[model samples]
Target: MTLSFFDQFMSPVLMGIPLMFLALTLPWALFAKPSPRVLNSRMVALQTWSIMGFVKQIFQPLSTPAHKWAMILTSVMMFIITMNLLGLLPYTFTPTTQLSLNLGLAVPLWLATVILGMRNQPTHALGHLLPEGTPPLLIPLLIIIETISLFIRPLALGVRLTANLTAGHLLIQLISTAAFTLISIMPTVAFLTGLLLFLLTFLEVAVAMIQAYVFVLLLSLYLQENV
Candidate 1:
């Protein structure tokens, strides 16, 4: 039976049990646990330093109130980046490529930011729906438009991630197949295609990391507006 290119996205199973949970939880265990000693092992120290740097850069533009989310946001970025990079490996499924998973992640977080804004600064949050200098004729239309945009933020977040990863994975599969098929017929052409595939793999690696960062960064921007 010929497998479809899209089959790669399917969650794998072992004896009828889904492995998605295992994939999701596996990344956390891969990290080094901190030691009680004054100096950590190299792995632990490197992990700590990288995390600190990531958090600082993400929160650089935000006010003190937003610093409270440093742990949550940083943890999310780490989780997502790990999952994305791991998905690029052979025979692995990418959970983030699914709209349901992405939406599950995005909606609650985006809603939290909006709800926080509504709770702590009701007027300021509501005011975002309408500009201060709106013309009398355009006020209603502008408010409607802004409201739609506000609600669409989460959907955009989920779709943007799902689409980017899905497209990249599909392209990789297609190119690799072409290279494999050409191997016996035209060795030189197949070699060139294989080289192209190698370069694309590196590009996808960068994309995986960037998409994860962009996902977190957009959420932080949403939070910035609220807090």
Candidate 2:
């Protein structure tokens, strides 16, 4: 049987049951729960400290009104990070690589921010469509352009995440396959390729984490503009 490179992006199935649900739920189980003890284990302590730092960094620039979204944003950050990292393991599927899944996550959050802004401060939200001191002739054109850009935000968010993860995974798979194929044909070349593959894998790990952070950071910026 011949396998296609794109096969890696497809959600797996077993006995007619899709595994995406399992992939989504498994990451929550790996999270460390806080202990009530005065001194928790080192792992829990580190996790707490890291999470606090992330929250602080994300919310620092936003007004008090935006702070209420801290929990939702934080949970999303953790979820994306976990899913991205998990997908790097052998035989694991990456849900974020799917455009549909990414769009599903991005649209509602982006729409909510937009809706919140419109509801709370309609004047300000609508004002964004027109810049101060614009020529009367350009008003219609600018408003049309701005409106299009506003709606494109969610699509851009989803595509950015899907493209990054999909590209990284595809590259890793291609390079590893090349390394394996060269092993018997040329030992020295194969060894060099293998070393390159190792480096690529490490880089992919970083990419996975960074992409997750970027996704969350952009969403927070959107929220900041709204709140």
Best by TM-score: 2
lDDT of 1 by residue, 69-143 (tens): 999888888888888998999978888898988999999999999999999999999999999989999999999
Q: What lDDT score belongs to each candidate, Candidate 1 first?
A: 0.94, 0.91
Evaluate model 1: give its lDDT: 0.94
Model 1: which ten-residue window has the lowest total lDDT?
A: 73-82
lDDT tens per residue, model 2, 1-227 = 98999999989999999999999999999999878898888888887897899999989998999999989988988898899999999999999999999899999999999999999988999999999999999999999999999999999999999999999999989888898899999989989988988998889889888887888899998888787
List runs of model 1 lying over 4 Å from the truth.
none
The TM-score values for the models, in the order shown, are 0.97, 0.97
* Residue-level error in angstroms, candidate 1, position 156: 0.8
Looking at model 1, residue 135 earns an lDDT score of 92
